[model samples]
Target: MKNLSLQWRITLMTALLIGATCIFMNVLIGYSGRHYMDSIGSHITGYEETGGEDPDFFDPRRERLDQELTIVIHGAQESFIATNWYITAAAALLGGVLAYFLSGHALKPLRTFAAQVEKVQPNNLTDTKIPEAVLPEFRQFSRSFNQMLDRLDSGFAAQRQFTGNAAHELRTPLSLMQAQLELFSAEHPEVSPETADFLRLLREQTERMTQMTKTLLEMSELRTVPCTERIEIGPMVEEIFTDLAPLAERKNITLKATGDGTMTGSDTLLYRLLYNLTENAIRYNRPDGTVHIAVAYEASCLHITVTDTGCGIPQPYRESIFQPFFRVDKSRSRENGGVGLGLSLAWEIVALHGGEIRVAESSEKGTTIAVSFPTDASAD
Candidate 1:
């Protein structure tokens, strides 16, 4: 009972009520019927015992008539009880069936409402609402849900605005600091060793901050980017490979790509998704390790897979790796000049295109990240 759905619960409760009523009615009717038959039989039999019938009938005849009356009354009572039991059982079962179907029909609107809610997303929340013309029972609920969505949409919009503003504001100070440090270093190349080292650290930190801000701004803007462009995979993969060739060479990692597919999405965002995956593969890989990317369109979904023979991510961290500032090995990520936002931005890009990304498989040997963009995202 605790685990049953609302519809089933309603059906069962109704069935139980109907069954109880039927049982009570059957019992009452059976008792009255048995009593009436016995009273009538006794009344007719009593006349004979009082000597109301002919004496020629004799005492043996009287006994026989009374015996027949007793037999008939008891038999009718037993048959009446049996019939009531059968009818009660039938009524209970029939009530349960009708209740089950009726409950399902009554709950259909709720199911449809749930499905529509499931389709709502952050980017598509503006103007998202359930119709007010729904069933009376759901009308108030629908209006309240829409109002909640409105509040949520407004909140998200404000957050995005804040992010964009904050990122832009930080970029200026970071650029200024970087530029001043460089100019000062150029002017005084003969500074003390300690001072020079300190300046270099400042420059590095400032540049890292700048890049972080840029990534943040891009993430916030992703929602506004249109995903209607038809982007091809082969050429884009080649471009990413070309851009990262120097880094791959420095790390002694091999790069490979195969298969081509086209998907409808923001060209820039799709490129970032590919580039981030490929870059991470190369940056974290073992010396002489290999990175392979494959693209395919199958079963109406565009799939992209990036496999790398790297220091494999642990099982638990696979899901966490996409979070902003999340790193499997903080020191190693820093050494790779990563501030831990590449994969985060990749995740944002995928979401903007209404796609899915996940670590397909991972172990001590290697890891494969799979991405899929199913169907057209422009429906939003």
Candidate 2:
């Protein structure tokens, strides 16, 4: 019943109700007619007349009356059944037609509200609102929906503004601190081993903070990035690998790229997306491990997958790994100076482009991360 459309459901219910009513009326009429015939037969045969005829006497008049009554009763019953069937069928047909149109009309407001809701997106969050419905129930629903959208639009705006401002303000101080440290280290070349180690640690932590701030700013700004460029994913992947090849070389990891496709989105965001995934693959991989990147057009979408022979992500941690500051291996992540924002940022970038990303496969042997974007050749 849930799988059926509203119009058909209404039609079926109406037909059943009319059909039952017709059956009840026919039964009542048939019962009344039988009772009336029985009374008439009793009178015609003189059963109520005491001592009017001998018992078992065959009177032609009375016999003819009995036969006529039986015939009349059977004929009336047959006629009533045939007539009721035609009336019932006509009533069912009429009820179904009326119910179909009535149901569609009754649901018009809901359909209108759905259409309005579909036009609301992050960029147009404040521009769209469901109109007041004529029906009281639908009007209440519209009001609630509009209120929710208002809260979301306002909250998102505040968060984005705060992130962008904080990141921008922190960068100058962070950069200055880094410069001062470099100068201090250079000036005090004869410092003790303990002092040198402390300075190195300080510098490393400073660099990590700077990178984190930069990533936050990028993620905040991504929501407003317009999708107007046709990015050839093949060349973008190639360029990212070229820049990170030296890093991969340190661990003897192999970087490979295969397949190509095109999508319409911000080139900068797309680069950041691929860069983050590829970098993580190389960073966490085993010595002599291989990182393979593949791109292809599948099911009307452009798919990009990064597979690495790294210690696979544990099943329990896979879902949370894409959350900001969430690390599967906290000790290893800290040792590698990772703040755990890479995957989170990458996920946001994909979402901004109306795409999807997921951990396609993971095991002790390797892990695969796949991203897909709707294919659009016109943008190319």
Candidate 3:
């Protein structure tokens, strides 16, 4: 009963009520019939009575009448009970069927409301209100739901505007500071050791801030990417390798790509996703270790695997690695000058293209990250 759906619950309760009523009426009618039979029988004839003229004579006619009355009353009671039981059973069954259908009809609006809520995504938030012409019972609920959606839309819009403005405002000052510091370092190569150290630390921190702001600005404005062109994974891999060749060389890690795949999405965003994955693979990897990239098409999906001989992520941090500013080893990440937004941006990019990214496997030997882009079902 606890696990039953609302519809079934209602139906069962209604049927039980109807069955109880029928049984109660049946018992009442049966008792009334028995009482009436007893009253009529007692008046109609006596069960045993001796004759008045003769001392030992019996009245067989009255005895026979009494016997007939008993038989008729018992037969009528038995017939009435059996017939009423059948009628009670039928009424319960019919009541359950009617209740089930009626309950389904009553709950149809809730199902519709749930489906509409499911379809409300960030990009498609406008005009998400349920129509005013809906049933009176749902009108208030729908109005409240639409108002909540309006608040969410406004919040999102305000957040994007603030992030974009802040990033833009901060970028110029950071760039100016970086240029001034570099120029100063070049002009005075004879600075004191303490001053040099302070300047270097300041430069690193400034660079970190600049990178974070740039990434944030990109994220804030990533809503309307022109994803018209089909991007080939092979060429994109080549480009990322060329850009990060110096970083790989510095770490003495070998980079390799195997197989070819293609997907249709924003080329710029997709490039960043791969770049971030590959860059992280190289950044955290051991000296002379290997970073391998593999792309393939399987089951109407494009899968890209990046495996690196780096310190593997712990089991608990696997999911949190995609979150902004989350790091498994904060100290090591800082040594690599990571702001922790590389993987976060990668995640957002993959999600924008309706893809998935996850840590496929990790161990002492190496870690493998898998990215998949789903294609149209018709292509399958």
Candidate 4:
């Protein structure tokens, strides 16, 4: 069937090829056997025509020539038939077995390559040594895989440098503003109500700036961090809900945490994971709409689904939603007060945690994002 896996497909194809070759050989041998039988029958007929008996005409005359000729013909027929069947069957079975093993041996390097790729971490990505192989097929695969790793290592290094530079640059201005605000407030102890309100607005803006800067730095760190620690994901989801409930309440968005979300990863990354989903839910939700957080295990993987009763993400932009600085509606995203890095950070965090985040479904009704984190059994 078309849906069969690669190993089975390879084995089946090999077996079929062997079977076809065996059938072809058998046909050839059958034809030869028929020719041999015909030649012997003609020789006997010629002897009968030339002499009174086949013995007189045949080489090395015998008393019972007809009987001897008939016995020889029967023995030849049986031997040819038996040999033909035995050789064909033996060749077919041997070819099939040989094919199966050869196919497996040829693919062994690929299997090892895949396993090596799975264990690659950002910190150790520079170590891209794939074991050598004498076979050309494996050698080519190794070269390509190493090339890809080289590119990834360079890309991640560049990203780290950029993140470090950006975070410092953004933080410097906020730090200056905060210090200036403290000095101004201290000096203007007798300031008027209007001036005080203005000062408060400035302080609020500075605080928001500081929070946004910290979130950006955290996102950057998440990229470089190897989440070696295991975390209880259910409690993490519950904690995130508890922390963000007030914000949802302020917007009249009801947030509900349901199911048990148990997975393995860093607590910080898990926090970010829940935060991004909840924030998206709250930002996109309609007035008095509900945001449901469902966390459960499925197929030996932890499934954390965030469903929101909001205007769904457009089909065209669903993939782009995870791109940095990408927003469905610029004005709406601006009104929501995010720089459009929420989903991007979420995606990176999930990826770093060795999980997959995807839009399971979306429609005019709402959107559902399903995140799958491998269980301990799976991770091993």
Please give each candidate's TM-score: 0.86, 0.80, 0.76, 0.71
Report the C-alpha lDDT of model 2 over 261-347, residue by residue, as the tens digit: 777788888898899999999999999999999988778777889999998999988889989999998999998879999999988
Of 1 and 3, which scores higher on lDDT? 1
lDDT of 1 by residue, 1-380 (tens): 89999999999999999999999999899989988998899889777667666656668766887888899889989998999999999999999999999999999989988898987877778646888898999999999999999999999889989999999999888888888998999999999999988998888888888889999999889877887897788999999999999999998999999988877888998988899999999998989999999988767788889999987989889899999999999999887889999998988887777788999999878899999887674221
Candidate 4 residue-wise lDDT, 1-380, digit = tens: 78986666788787788778877887788788878887887787677666655443545444377567767777887788778778877877887788778878877777888788887866457564686664786787777777887898889878877876788798999999999999999988999999999998898778767766776787767655656676766687778878888888888998787777445567777787788888889888888988998877788887889999898988899899998789899989766777778888888787776678899999888899998877752332
| Model 4 poorest 10 in a row by lDDT | 54-63
Q: What tens digits encode model 3's per-residue C-alpha lDDT throughout 110-223?
A: 888989897676654665667757899999998899888889989988998998899999999999999999999999999999999999999999999999999999988888
User: In model 3, which runs have C-alpha deviations exceeding 4 angstroms?
Assistant: 1-5, 28-76, 115-124, 127-133, 249-262, 286-310, 354-380
lDDT score at residue 367, model 3, on the 0-100 scale: 97
Ranking by lDDT: 1, 3, 2, 4
Error of 1 at 157 (Å): 1.3
Report the alpha-carbon TM-score of model 4 versus the true structure.
0.71
- State the C-alpha lDDT per candidate: 0.89, 0.85, 0.87, 0.79
Cα displacement (angstroms), candidate 3, residue 288, comes to 5.5
Scored by Cα lDDT, where does model 4 land? Answer: 0.79
lDDT comparing candidate 1 with the true structure: 0.89
The lDDT leader among the candidates is 1
Q: What value does the lDDT take at residue 168 in candidate 4?
A: 76
Provide the RMSD of all predictions against the true structure, rounded to 1 decimal: 3.3, 4.8, 4.8, 6.0
Candidate 4 local lDDT, residue 193: 98
